[model samples]
Target: MSFIKKRTSHNYDIYESRGHIIGRITLLTGLIFTFLPPLFLWLVYGIMPPSKELINGIISISSVMLPVSIVEILAFSPMLGTNAMYMSYLTGNIANIKLPSAAIALEVAEVKPSTEEGDIIATIAIGGSVIASEIVILIGMLLIVPLSTKLNNPVIQPVFQQILPALFGSIGAYYILKEWKLAIAPLSVAILLNLVGDLPTAVTIPLCILSSILTARLLYKKKLIKVTD
Candidate 1:
């Protein structure tokens, strides 16, 4: 048993090390490709926005996005695992699409996040979702002109808005039911904060994460919740 455990640990370490290397390389490549279009226009046509306007635009966007980005990394990394995080960020639509897919995948696989099995499952799930989304997007593009009228119909607009809320609500309910004690603190904090005033997601996300962590620690300390290996 000891030898088997050691071998498993060795294999997992190698898996994680390779995951990091590949994730970093792909992410850096994606970043370079992301900037290539603007660089092309600037170099080939000498076409670029005014320096002052560009600086202001960047600051305005970065101020909001930087905090949110940092918070998302901290909040989602544990649940997403390293490779899934890199893939989801590279593909975008993480909150609405990739996150829910990963959550559902983990639940179905009966694997806890941040573990070796969970990491592998999540990476595979996210990869599948990315491909599925691309196919859907391609079909949408092909059909968009024909379906434009119906898609833009007032009655259908409300349904589109509710999709994300419904998706998250179902996932939240599942976890909350499974571990209501752990959910209480963060849920209460979120509700109270929202009731007081509408807090930006950047502000609320970190607070919620902190509350959940503290609550879990307190529960474990109190022997209210048992930790399992």
Candidate 2:
């Protein structure tokens, strides 16, 4: 038993070490590619925004996105594990697509998050989802010109708007059903906040996460929830 445990730990450590090295290389490559289009325009066309305007543009976008990015990293890292996090960020759509796919994969595989097995499963699931989404996007792009009018119809527009909410709601429902006690605090907070006013996701998500963590801790201390290995 000791030998098996040690071997598993060793393997996991190796996986994490390699994952980090690969992740960094891939992310750096992606970053370079991301700047390529702007670089091309500047070099070939000599077309560039004024320095002041560029700075302001960057600041405006960053002000909104930086907080959300930080919050997402904190909230998602544990569930996604290191490798999956790298891939999800690179692919984009972490919240709407990668996250749900990874979560559902974990649930289906009966693996707990933050474990070696869970990390491996999540990475695979995310990769698959990325491929699937790309294929769908390709198809959509091809069809969009032809279908633009139909897609923009008011009835269809409403359905498109609801798609993300429906996806999240379904996943949330499953988890809440499984752990209703743990859901109480966070769910209530989310609902109350929605009723009170429109809060940015960066604010509401972190608060809900904090509330859930505290509630879980309290429940565990009171012997209201069981921890199983």
Clashing pairs in 2: none
Tell me the lDDT of model 1 at 131.
Answer: 98
Give me the runs in candidate 2 sitting further than 4 Å from their true place: none
What global local distance difference test value does model 2 have?
0.91
Worst 10 residues of 2 by lDDT: 199-208
lDDT by residue for model 1 (53-138), tens:
99999987887788889978887899899889989998999977888899899988889998888888999999999999999999
lDDT of each model, Cα atoms only?
A: 0.90, 0.91
RMSD of each: 2.4, 2.3
